[model samples]
Target: MNNTISSVCLPKTYTYDVEGQRVLVALTGNPFNYDPQTLYSLAARRNKKRGFLFVSKVLGKHVPVNPYVPLLAGINLGAHFIEKIHGVHQVDVQAVVEAVKKNEQTKEVYARVISQPRFVLPRETLFIGFAETATGLGHAVFSLFDNAHYLHTTRDKIPMLQPALDFNEVHSHAVNHLCYPENPELLKTSKTVVLIDDEITTGNTALNIIRAIHEQYAIKDYVVLSLLDWRTKDNRGNFRKMEELLCLKIRTLSLLEGEIDVSGSSYHEQSPQNLTTDTENRESFQVIVEEQLLNLQEVVSVFSVDVNGQESASPYLKVTGRFGLSSREDQDTLPLAREIGENLKPHRAGGKTLCLGTGEFMYFPMLISAFMGEGISYHATTRSPIYPFPKPGYGIQNAFTFPCPDDEGISYYVYNIPLNYYDELYVFLEREVSLERLQPMLRVFSQLGIPRLSLVIASPVSRKTEKR
Candidate 1:
């Protein structure tokens, strides 16, 4: 079955009876403007704190999906947001609705954008994407904005980069997120800030980040951008109040909006639960995996910031659009991506391959993976820990555990890869690494029987650091 949002994987109205209450998620087409069923599939969450997970077919998380789907989702969403900002949202919304009525996928819908007039924001406008899930989506949206600056939150903190702001995602497997922009001035002078995430369940996480940033800097306006918005009526009211309390204007733009009903025997009022997991060793799959690992090829590449023709190495130098990226820096991305893709071409023999970014190091690998063609799927190693239940219809099927070198206390996970599916794997990182950090991931892939492997490590350099 095609797992994309435009496929028959979901229906207009989906009902689930869990934990005794009959819950319904309705995505009717006519009046509401967009189809929620076309955007997401409802699945059970492995975390008991949250009963249901709104599995996004386009977000490229939890599911193996085409890379273009999520990228187009962000670009279209960015176009919609620009229209809303310019007070011409009706035209854009109608165009999107028409595109959906024709059952268009991300690429087709993105083409409809030509029907709308161009909209631009100030050069100083800042775009921030939530980490792990929305990192690429957020960057894609920023790319559509011409020269706007972009940064995604990261749970990993680089020693060389000073922290600008920090916040918590209370219900997430990894709760803390730190922002360490290489150029501190990027956040200080912005008049409008656009916060992007894959989904907004309660609006609390957005509120937390907004509250934290508003405390440091006085912002004129804030835009909450997401592919899906499931915030309740009360949640909307609270956002309005937050706007008033912060003395700033707040707005939200999403492709789909509706209520999710999570009822029945599975529903429980959850306490603030800590993320804990019991590691499972898949001894049965070890032999085949070792054979594949032995046959795999490995390569490493590095990028350093140039200063007067001299290359200098620094951990947080901002090469991958981690902080804010402009058009000039972005120009280097395509060629580098093409180079990475060319290097992996000889290993392509028809089976599936995957490119993985370790934690917040996602956008660069995602971009490079796109150049590797259709067979290469993209995802990341995330700090979020979820229960791995290999049952049908669950969001998380299989998970590979690795120690988080960035944070020794917490373990990282890469999920949903079935055994023997991927023929090759490419791993990307931002820093020079030791073999200690790679062993777990290598062991996991070896166990899964993925024969070929490529490791790309790029170091970042900052203009600000060079100036000093």
Candidate 2:
């Protein structure tokens, strides 16, 4: 498809009244003259710390969008960054659109473009993607950089895994994020870094992480990549101050750079905090779990990790992030995604299918979802808990809660999906699963009247070796 960014809806003024404070959100910049509505819209956040949320239209989290949209958006941003890094001005929107087309026509073009970096990063540079939303975006961008290591922060901690760095996202419901690279040298050898996120509101989180990483390892160049740059005038100035303080060059890139004005009253508006059903009035919904129908596999692969002369075999396939994903695994992503799609087609013979990824395990599942044919929607279960208001103009209308497979105590949610919208649902997991972990979600789906549900398990390829 010859899709162009011109078709995107441009920004306009948005205003809302929240908790007695009058909030006004307006779009200020249209560098690409793209439609702001097509890119994002304004929604009031449930969190008191942040009143307004610039909900992305392309991100499949709060809303269901064509899988191609978010994937293409990230690729486009990568192209722009490449242009800037190489000092090539000719690689404009048209060039990016063409490149996307070429990529769609054949994987050869995509491979060629990604392998041959238009701009090279320092040999020691690391590409880190924020948890949840930007995990996929960062993966896409990381593929475009030559010889760069990739890792994404996570709220879920693996057993016996230690973080190389940990930081806080103040505005997020789950504030703390842990970064664990299998090889400590992945962070030790880093001299430059690119922080990827869905958007940059205050740039504070980026700054916070930068400071945390610098405290541990020296970094010289820092770049922030996002789908939208909504940093206020003061926020942009803060970056300059941070640069001087941190003694590093800080830059930002985005498909859209603009302002949002939030004006609303201080009158408190109560939104539904969590899914509640009146015990007396609630209808009895029966839920059933058919474990025999679920495609659960136990691959007895041997994974070795050597630390301090101790060698042990772990029954895990640790291909990528949390421990960090290498260049080889990055190269395998496309082919693996294609194989997954082919394997999933027979199972998708139902109307309005939904592909759901496990929390923090987003990028790979999203790619598989996008490739699973039309009338298919994609989103991942997230650790961030947002309130659902059953009203128009609200981003989250309905939410389904379930126990996270990795950590059963922590709750995860898939939002905006109504009970019967999708007749078929596919849940993708990056780790091995258990009947215990899958029961909660399966029961939720059964209650929602989803006719067919399948669990697809593809563990990451274990590339860990004993480092002499």
Candidate 3:
């Protein structure tokens, strides 16, 4: 007799009850294309080019993304534009909450979206959202598409993360290009694969993904959804071109229309000359994490971790440790988080000093903050933000932009800690570092107005000072 046990993983999405279930996508104001000043002061006069611009053969502003279009993104994403354009929105965030409430309007919108004469999604149909950008909207859509398997691509990299289908976004941060897709079968067998993103700029990103998926899974039909659609009537030609190119049909919907002005050639690189500098002093900075922020919901467990390696002081800062795992937690992440958390001590949360984590570094901080009592706020920046486009009275919902690192560029994420927002910060990394790279990163933070507070969670010890 063969012994068998059920798999701990989620079952195929084909088996779910969607008898009367509906999924809807709503837009607040018109769609604003993302072409904002990536490095602007919040209160600075709003640039006229801010907001999504529609550039097609019809509205031929066609230079590239930044050259023709200017948009405001981060501070508050597209929600900000909605508040500005339609007195109807409350800039503080309730509008997005209200818009997402899924009331009757939500039901009606879903009814239109899932317009199949019959009810219920077919078995094997999956919801595939883009990484970094559509992280939230994908989750929201998942809430409604309860019957669908919910998994979004992630830029986060653990020691070992595999990608189902890796693709590219011409305009995105370099570090986040590695997308770890959750469902490998997502490209295969699913009849309806929903491509969700915040906004559709050139529709290039979507086109790229669609092309990749076609080349891989070869799905015949795909649907593109967003809070706003900036594509003008002429942009439809590109859609037709892709349709002919891939022999697949891609349909899109949004609450309204907007446009993005283009100025430079598509290949023009917009790397900021001095955004992400790499030579800040390391030990000059220190970190204190707030403890009250441990154990983030429904995900990983939080625990106390001890350092594995001895600490030393030298021209370079050295810190290393193994993250202890709680019995209730998955053992895999323990060694990593704990090993790093210990040396980062004097841990405290809820204050000006921030312990910013790289993608999967989320758990380490959660655990580290457990030791760090009240003096910190724990949040990480996804490679996404709302940006101002050149169009009028419209906004782009979710597009991501990063400072070109070629010159010392800054990588802004959804959780942007504007320099004015915090006294100082200690950016934590999951990558290997030298004293030079780690130290200078700190000094740079100091220059930004606050003393730098940094910690080396997992770095090698140096010969200058053998013991801590």
**Top of the candidates by TM-score:** 2
TM of each candidate vs. truth: 0.78, 0.81, 0.45
lDDT of 2 at 238: 92
For candidate 1, lDDT tens digit of each residue in 11-129? Answer: 35556543233557654222335455456655444465676566676666656665555656676678778777865452355545544344345345544553343345654678899
Model with the higher lDDT, candidate 1 or 2? 2
Root-mean-square deviation of Cα positions for candidate 3 versus the true structure, in angstroms: 17.5
Worst 10 residues of 3 by lDDT: 58-67
> Which consecutive 10 residues in model 1 have the weakest lDDT in total?
290-299
- Tally clashing residue pairs in candidate 2: 28
Better candidate number, 1 or 2, judged by TM-score: 2
lDDT of 2: 0.65
Instruction: Report lDDT (Cα) of residue 76, candidate 2.
Output: 75
Reference-based TM-score, model 3? 0.45
- In candidate 3 the C-alpha lDDT for residue 74 amounts to 17
Residues 1-468 of candidate 3 have per-residue lDDT tens digits of 011223233220111111111111122233332212211111101123221122121010111111001111111233343243223342334422222322113223332332322113444445555554344344334332223454455443333335565677765543233433333454565765666665675677778777877887888777776645656457767888989988888877543434423333211123223222232432333433211222122221111111222222211111111111111223223344444445454542226555554433333443343233334444434432333223322222122233311112334432233333555454544333344544433444444444445553432222222222
Ranking the candidates on TM-score from highest down gives: 2, 1, 3
State candidate 2's TM-score.
Answer: 0.81
